[model samples]
Target: MDKIGFIGLGIMGRPMAKNLIKAGYAVVVCDVNQQAVEELRACGAESAATPAETAEKAGTFIVTMLPNSPQVREVTAGENGLLKGIRAGQIVVDMSSISPIASRELDALLREKGAEMLDAPVSGGQEKAEQGTLAIMVGGSAAAFEKARPILEKMGATVTLVGESGAGQITKLVNQMIVGINISAVAEGMAFAKKAGVEPRRVFEAIRKGLAGSQCLEDKAPRMFEGRYDPGFRINLHIKDLWNVLETSRAVSCSVPLSGQVIEMMIALANEGHETKDHGSLGLYYEKLNNVALKEIQK
Candidate 1:
């Protein structure tokens, strides 16, 4: 197995990197969070002090799972960045949810150094990340995709090369757009049902197998009913993705009214300090609107 350099060991990144180690790859990791790095180090992975050192030590593949475009850019191009030490023929797989435009610009930078970059973002949140069942979407050259496929497969159940440079990030934005909208719809509908004197759990059990079913509904509705708002995916992060959606839509002269509305709901939740809560707490938004709450009803 090739030596892998992993960066940004956060909620998603930490588990994904650990899966690579479990797959028998020699992994070197870097993160500002020393505890996370130490945790992976204790799991038989090596640790690096900086991205540049990580790049120099890794054999071919370097993966980054970060927050947004700014963080990704800083790690890849800032002083003491991976670009400082990345060599010819190296492949950088960025799994961060960022701007497609930024992905393209970074790809251009990597290409100029005789290296390749793949904009590979993922879905399925923290749960699937820990289970190594994320759905990864890649955008880059076919050759790079093939080279990275084995590494990706170890961490994702579904790894797809969607299109050329920046395409994966665009696809991620689409995912976020639909996810925000679906979460809002689920919250609104469930809250309405509860307010109308229907058992929210029964409503979920009834419609979950019907045409209204979705991954979002199945995952989030239960969280809503249980009143558990832990961060499978945080409201603030979804808000960030939604802002990217609206910005990209504007760039392409497209309109996304539903996304616009959902973003407002996210902003409202964030304003109320629910930003760190799971996006399933979108139910709280509707609950407040209707003056009703979603609590665990006996199944």
Candidate 2:
């Protein structure tokens, strides 16, 4: 089997690397967090001291599951970046949610060195990542996608090659836009139900089978009702995702009226200090606006 380099061992990255290991790949992993690297090393993955080391270990293909574009740049550029040691015919597949423009720029840079790049951001959150059931949106050359398909298949249930360079990030931005708007809508709906003396849970039960239902409503409404705001996906991350959408929309001269409004509301919520909370905590914003708490309604 071919060796693979995996970088970023956060919530999603850890499990993703694990699945690759379980699939019997020769996986070499790296992260800024030594502890995260140690944990993966314990799971039969070889440890690389740096991103460049990981790239050198797996010359043909490397996978990055980083946080944002800046982190992506840091890991792929400069003396310490993966590109420093990467050779031609090698491929770097970024599963990080980043701007399409940034991905395109990186692709150009990597191509100059005889390597290829794929913008292949994923959806389905940590739970799906842990279960190896993410939906991966890929954008790159057809041959590059084919080379990376088997490895990507181990981590995602749905892996699609959307189009050429940067299209995956574009698709992921679309995914985040809908997710941001949908979760906020779910939050407001739950809040309205509580304020109207209806049990938020029962309200979800009623709409869950109707046209008003959505994956966001089912996944987030219960957490909103229970006031469980643990960070499965942090609000700050979603805020960044929304900012990407807004910025990309502006660059393309696209008018996303509803998405723009949701981005403003998310910024307001984050500014009010909900950035560390789970995005489900957005329900609390509506609660504050209405001066009615779900806990009070439950009583």
Candidate 3:
């Protein structure tokens, strides 16, 4: 029963940490938000004053589910960061969506300090986080993956070791690219259905059982119909992921035409102030473009 340090208690982080605790892991928690720290404390977690302290208490296994690469750097390399306290043979598993190159650099830096790094970015949104059914894509040495697997199993349904040191981030970038493009296509399909005098829900029902169906359509189309754009996964986060994908693709000299277009559309939607909404709210952008109010469709 190894002790664990869990950092970053935002929408997905909080639930994932909770699952680890509920599975009987001794979790030491930290977050910049005092309220998030307090919530974890109430759930039987020990609160740490800083990432370094958390690392000191947990010793070898630390998990961070942060917002982005910069935040990841701040927690791991800042003055009071985790690296300041991490010792030899310790493992730092970063489950944040970040660049593979950044993960590779961090891996090298952490290794110099006698610690190992793993990029284990996740998918399936907040709902899956709460359910402990996330899809985790891991990239690290085989030994590090073995050390982290048991704990990761508590937080995800499908955990895969895609490759070594930054491969997980690459896989996650591919995941986001397909998700962004598919969700946009779903939005466009819904809009087409609405404009053509077909019942949007029926259109969803008809196509859902056909070749055009997808997990995105099944999970997000109903929410779009109900106008429930709650932030299971924020629109801005997808925009950030796309930005990472664009940069990663450029670095590899790869062309992702659909990914590029989807990124631009997400940027436009975010610029129009839908950043805080759910990614499914792209449907609203399509609705507006076609001059069809969501309420009108419900009638």
Candidate 4:
């Protein structure tokens, strides 16, 4: 087992890195957050002062769980970046959900330096990251996928190589689109039920077993009912993902009408300064629209 260099130890990254450490891999970590790096270090992982340092000291694999396209681009290309210290044949697994176009650009940059890249964006949120049961969508060559699958399996429950180069990010954008749409639908339904003087949680239980049922309803409905809007996956991040979704849609001349509508609603929530809350907080937007507040139903 080669030593893995891990960067960007935020909510998702920290747990994934910890899982790697627990799985008996020698993991080296780097992040802007010193406490995050130190936390991993306490778990038997080595800490690097920078991405370049991690790449230099760690083995053939580097995993980055960054926030967005620009950050990913910067961390791999900046002065003390991954490319500065990478050797030929080393691989980069970017688990961030970002722009597919940007993923392709990063792939080209890595290939130019005689390295391989996999855009392996993950879903299933921070809790999944902690439990090592994330759903990882990978896009890269078959060889690279095979080489990376074992390491990926350690962090994800469902790992699949979907296509080449940018497919993983494209997949992630699709995931975000569905997520945004689903959350919005749940928000709308719960708000409507509350406005109609029906218990939204009871409505959730009734419809949850029918054709209207879905994981979104199951996972997010209670949160909306309880008015808990803490950031598991921040609404702002979903907004960013939708931005990528729309940008990529325009590039390919695809019409994402529902996605566009959801983005508009998300932007409304963000502009109102609710972007830092969990995406399930979308119900608030509907609550405002309906002029009704949803009360938590008795379990």
lDDT of each: 0.93, 0.88, 0.90, 0.91
Instruction: Tell me the tens digit of each residue's lDDT in model 3 across 1-299.
Output: 78899999999899999999999898999999999999999999998999999999995799999989999999998989988998999999999999888899888989999898999999888889999999999999999998889999999999999999999999999888988899999989889888988878888888898888999999889998888988877889998998899888899999999988887777788889888898888888888889874433444
Better of 1 and 4 by lDDT: 1
Candidate 1 regions exceeding 4 Å error are 194-202, 296-299
Return the TM-score for each candidate structure. Answer: 0.93, 0.92, 0.93, 0.94
**Candidate 1 C-alpha lDDT tens digits along 119-178:** 999988888999999999999999999999999999999999999999999999988888
For candidate 4, the 10 contiguous residues with the lowest summed lDDT are 290-299
Task: Name the lDDT value of residue 72 in candidate 2.
Answer: 92
Tens digits of per-residue lDDT, candidate 4, 1-299, equal 79999999998999999999999999999999999988998999988888889889888899999999999998898889898998899999999989999999888988988997899999888889999999999999999999999999999999989999999999989889988899999999888888788888788878899998888888889888888889878889999999999889999999999999998998999999998999988888998988888746456
**Model 1: lowest-lDDT 10 consecutive positions:** 290-299
What lDDT does model 2 reach?
A: 0.88
lDDT of 2 by residue, 73-104 (tens): 88998567888889999999999999888899
Give the residue spans of candidate 2 off by over 4 A.
193-202, 295-299
Clashing pairs in 1: none
TM-score of 4: 0.94
- TM-score: model 3 vs. ground truth: 0.93
